[model samples]
Target: MGNYKWHPRFLNPPRYRKENSQLNIHLWNIMKARVSTNVEKVYERLRVIVS
Candidate 1:
């Protein structure tokens, strides 16, 4: 196994700016789409959250 170290920025992201956040949101949407029983329902929920 390889040793891994966490970066300081990863522990504490800067506030009021969305750099890494957007990636997280994108991943969340993808995951929801994959597992969702109703794709439209998931999309509606995401729209409510994002909007």
Candidate 2:
């Protein structure tokens, strides 16, 4: 692979951000499903990011 730097901050966190409301609702539904399971820690982290 090329010398691509992995930037975790560039990645989208898993949360329902009101600011990104312009995005597709269907995409949000899928995100909600991904974060709705036994991923409490990740969810909390994402919530912080959203806030």
Candidate 3:
């Protein structure tokens, strides 16, 4: 969680201000996709266990 807060600075960096928007969007999308996939996997596992 704390690492997520510092992600903007780490991803943006001071050397590449021009590419920040696209880079940030791409990284954020990847992270969101991973999170959703993990959530679905967990939900499926729980459902199997419950049944």
Candidate 4:
């Protein structure tokens, strides 16, 4: 296994900051929705078992 050093190029901000930020926000919302739905399904299953 080779040890990799942090590269300076990776630290630079994206040239298209506005568009990148918008895309990031959209992806974040999708992730949040998926997580919430999974949680709801688990809760419902537990509720049924309890009842």
Runs off by more than 4 Å, candidate 1: 1-17, 37-51
Most TM-score-accurate candidate: 4
Prediction 3 TM-score vs. true: 0.65
Q: Where does model 3 exceed 4 Å of error?
A: 1-18
Candidates in order, TM-scores: namely: 0.38, 0.29, 0.65, 0.67
lDDT string, candidate 2, 1-51, tens digits: 343323443235466576564464567688887777649878889999999
* Candidate 4, 1-51: lDDT as tens digits: 233323543333446577776876687699899999999999999999999
Best of the two (1, 4) by TM-score:
4
The 10-residue segment of model 3 with minimum total lDDT is 10-19
Model 4 Cα shift for residue 31 (angstroms): 0.3
Angstrom error at residue 16, model 3? 8.1
How would you encode candidate 1's per-residue C-alpha lDDT over 2-47 as one tens digit per residue? 3322455543556635856787567768877777758777899999
Whole-model Cα lDDT of every candidate shown, in order: 0.67, 0.62, 0.82, 0.72
Candidate 4, pairs of clashing residues: none
lDDT of 4 at 29: 90
Per-residue lDDT for 14-51 in model 3, tens only? 67666676877788899999999999999999999999
Show the lowest summed lDDT stretch of 10 residues, model 2.
2-11
RMSD list, candidates in order: 10.8, 13.0, 4.7, 6.2
